[model samples]
Target: MTTPVLEARGLSRAFGHVLALDDADFEVYPGEVTALIGDNGAGKSTLVKALSGNLAVDSGEIKFAGEPIQLTSPTQASALGIETVYQDLALAPHLDPVQNMYLGRELMRGGLGGAVGLMNVNEMRSQSRVAFDELGATVRSLTTPVGSMSGGQRQAVAIARAVHWANKVVFLDEPTAALGVRQTKNVLETIRRVRDKGIAVVFISHSMPHVMEVSDRVQVLRLGHRAAVLDAKHTNMEELVGLMTGASTKGAA
Candidate 1:
């Protein structure tokens, strides 16, 4: 009976004639992985955006750490230690790992150096290296541009960066797309490490096998709302697919 770290009820969002999120309800607990899966246009993306403060909900209630709060902007969410890593990874292709890690929130030097717009490059690099090491990410060279790295390495860097800054919740969108077996294994291991840090990991994916393998609880979305929230251990992929396709209603939340 652990309290959910993040919770939403009656969430709705519309785009002209289309309803992206229709009274969707979702929850994720601290220190556990929650998978959000659905067919195309089933409101998975919409719900992620709503909870991450990238999109406003037309109607609903959101509770963070048992307190109702409004996420008016991405900054507000970040302040609350909420970070989202989209499928794109959002890393700067040209910048190195250290640079990309502190892309927006760069550290400034002290006093005169700070007044002259000098960055604390050494400190940033040190912290970046520590983060990579802590996450068990294999980065041969932190100085190389992320564009040159393999997809899995780049994914590790992106996830490591998010985990370093996020203390409460991190929403990952399709972290293991198009990765080789070894690379995918590394990425999954990194996720377990993040969860062990007492952070809520919301994994959004279309791969049922990956979802079933990594998630503690699977929340299925159909049409525009939550169809079922089933224990991942007890539910099979066939049941998840059935719930997503509206072919079965045996596991309604």
Candidate 2:
């Protein structure tokens, strides 16, 4: 086994008396997609929030690249090469693909010519195009506003943006939740491309078939705890559903 690119041990979080995550343990490797599957209130949200620095962990340790680290905020996580794409997409509807891709991380023209804080439009466009091309994203027009693009196209842009800035792990929350069949396939392929680029993908989804198809491993959360981790190829939907619902106690083989 190889060292995990990202890992959490004994991760716990609480909302008043409710224990969201209870001594949870999770890990994902580079070049692989680890599907996080569970019923509602299974603590998947808490676990991911802790790892992504959206929520503080009550008791746990997060290690990145074999070193102990503290992710106190989303910016801190991003600084450490962690990027998350939420279900809402967090995109500007009025902005074009390039505009959305470089939203907050826009490049500023440097040197004496950059004294006035001019935006580096051409350079940003070039880089965005390269990222889209690399991921095989299907965007009809980079100049078109993101709101006008199809859901799949917007998803592609979101993913491309994440891939461009991500150096280690990318957390994708229900990436294909609102897509059609073809769009879902496109997003799934884009995910594979991300993995091919050697970035670990933490995919959260309720779709069993999607998980089984895209993930190298599946981690099931149950009642605020780590239920089981199964090899996707060897495990079937029945076994995974069983584990998630507390019908089984089997861990990864």
Candidate 3:
């Protein structure tokens, strides 16, 4: 069997006296979408923060590509090919897709010491276009600033940016939260594309239908601890909800 792309064992975190995450065990496999679902204050965000290196874990182990890793910062996670796209969609509204895609990690023609020192705008644009195309995104102009795009378009840009840079896993927080039906479909399709490309995806969402539609497995968290994990094919929304609410015991295989 192929090893998991990202795995967390005995993951725990706390804020002051409040335990935000408790012994959360999660695993994501290449080319698969794993939905992390829970109600408000269920520790989904906390788990994500720890997994993405935005917050330190009190005790736990994270293994990427089957090897133990210490992720101290978001940059460290990115360096290890772990990219996270939060609900806020962190794009500069004033910048175009290409610029936003390459925001901090802009491609330069050469190092500062090199004779040719210049930003590679053309290279960034070309790559951004390729990334969007791969996801079947309908961004007419890579030159159009993100603020001018619709919410779905902005979400697409964020996902595209992650795909362009991430080599291992991607974490998406509430990807379709406020998107219209069509826009949500677009975003979901882009997620499918990401999974098809052999990238492990940890999708966090509250919409049960969306979770059932796109996820291979569903993991439910309640009060900072894992409630259950169920196979999407084998469970229904009611069952999932029940598990999340501590009313049922069945879970994903």
Candidate 4:
């Protein structure tokens, strides 16, 4: 069998007296969308923070591409080609799509200009356009501030930014939180496209219907522990909800 692109074994984390995650196990395969679904305070966010290197686990093992690794910070995770798109989208309200995409990692000009720390605006703009286009993002005017775009468009830009730099996996936390029906559909499509491109996608959401529709596999977190990992197609909503609420464990794959 082919090794998983990303895996976590016996992961645990705590905040003072509260045990956020307890011996959690997770895996994300290439070209697949693995949905991490659970109720609020079920350690979904904690696990995400740990995986994305925002929070350190008290005990666990993380392997990326079959190699053991440690991620102490978000910068370390990003350097390992792991990108995260949080619920807020994390775009500069005043900046345009191109500018937001190249926020911290800007291109520098060659020779004397590079030595002086001059940004290569033209190159950054061109590359951002290509990345957005590849993600099928609808940015009619790349020059307009991202704050002015619709919720769906902003979500698309955030996803594009992750996929642009992430060679390993993309962790999306509540990507379709407050959007309308149409906007939610658009964002979900973008997510599927991201997975189709052969990058592993860890989709964290509360919407069970959306999870069922988009995920190839579903990992249920209940009380900081993995209750079940089931095939998305074979599992029903009732089974998922039951597992999450500590009522059922019939389906564990």
Candidate 5:
């Protein structure tokens, strides 16, 4: 079998005396979307923080591409080809899509020693459009500020940025939250496109129907522990809900 793109074994995290996450195991395969579902306070956010290198793990191991790695910071995670799109869809409201997409990792031209080093604005604008197109996003122009775009458009831009830059895995937190029906459909389709690109995706959401529609597998967390892991094809929403609520066993009923 091929090695998973990302894996966590016995992963745990704590804050003072509170155990935010117990020993949790997860695997994300290439070209698949794995949904992480749980109720509020189930440690979903905590696990994401640890996996994305925003919080330190108290124990367990994290392996990326079959190699053990210590992710000390978000930069380390990004360097390892892991990108995260938080619930807020972190984008500068005042910046255009092209500018927001190339915010931190801007492309530049010219030699390191010369003053010729300048932001390649044209290249970024052109490439950003291509990425958006690949995701089936009908972004009319990349010059519109993010704040002026619709909620779905903003989410699309955020996802496009991750897919365009990250080579390994992408973590999406509550990606479709607060989106209208049409907008939600658009974001979900974009996610499917990302998975089809052979990049592993960790989709975190509380909506069972959405999870069932897009995920290949589902991992349920309850009270800081992994309550169950099941094939999405074999599980129903009731079973998943039971698992997340800690009413069902690991394999669900």
Candidate 6:
């Protein structure tokens, strides 16, 4: 078996009197899509946050590439090549695609222009275009504010940005939520493209059809812990629902 690119063993987190995660175990391998499915308050968000360095775990171990590491901050996670796209799709409404792609990391020209704080707009635009094209994201106008773009287009930009910066794994939270049929199709296609490039994708959503349609494996969370992990091909919706609802504890091979 391939070593998991990201793994969490006995992960736990608490918020005041609430336990958001309780010994949650999870893993995602390279070049495959892993669906993270659970009902409300199942600890999916808490687990993702701990793995992505947005939130520290109360007790557990996170292994990356067979070595243990501390995820103290999102920047630390980014440095280790892990990226997350939250459900909110945190893109700047007033900025264009190219600008949004770079955000705080805009390339600056060398010498005088660099000292004068001039951004290398042309270079950034060229690379942003390549990233979008590589991800097959159709952004008709690269110069328009992303807020004005369609939902599908905005989602594409978010995924492309995450993939561009992430070399190992990318966590996507409810990527297709509230999207129309055509838009969801486009987003799912982009996800496949990302996986084909050898990055592990952690897809978290409540949509069973989408989970079955796009995932190679399904990891179900119940209450505050992982209920089971099953091969997507060998599992059915009823079984998944059973696991999530604690009606069944047996896991599929």
- After superposition on all C-alphas, the RMSD of every candidate to the true structure, in Å, is 1.1, 1.4, 1.9, 1.4, 1.9, 1.4
**Where is model 4 more than 4 Å wrong at Cα?**
251-253
User: Per-residue CA lDDT of candidate 5, range 21-82, in tens?
Assistant: 88887788899899998999888898888888999999999998898999899989998888
Go through the candidates in order and give each one's C-alpha lDDT: 0.90, 0.89, 0.88, 0.89, 0.87, 0.91
On the 0 to 100 scale, the lDDT of residue 87 in model 5 is 94
User: What TM-score would every model get versus the actual structure?
Assistant: 0.97, 0.96, 0.94, 0.95, 0.94, 0.96
Give the C-alpha lDDT of model 2: 0.89
The superposed Cα distance between candidate 1 and the true structure at residue 138, in angstroms, equals 1.9
Enumerate clash totals for all models, in the order shown: 0, 0, 3, 0, 0, 0
Q: Write the per-residue lDDT of candidate 4 for residues 41-90, one digit (tens) a residue.
A: 99999998888899889999999888989989998999888999998989
At residue 216, candidate 4 shows an lDDT of: 95
Specify the poorest-scoring 10-residue window by lDDT in model 4.
Answer: 244-253
Candidate 2 ranges beyond 4 A from true positions: 251-253
**Total clashes, candidate 4?**
0
Give the candidate number with the greatest lDDT: 6
Question: Any residue pairs clashing in model 3, and if so which?
Answer: 229-252, 230-252, 231-252
Candidate 6's residue-wise lDDT over 1-253, tens digit each? 9999999988989899999998889999999999999999999988998999999998999999989989999989998899999988899989999998998788999999999999999999999999988877888889999999988889988988999999999999999997899878887887888899999999999999999999999999987888889999999999999998988898432
Q: List where candidate 3 sits over 4 angstroms from the true fold.
A: 111-117, 251-253
lDDT of candidate 2 over 93-192, digit per residue (tens) = 9999999998878888998667887889999999889989998888788899999988889998898888888989999999999999998998888889
lDDT of 3 at 233: 98
In model 1, the runs with Cα more than 4 Å from the true position are none
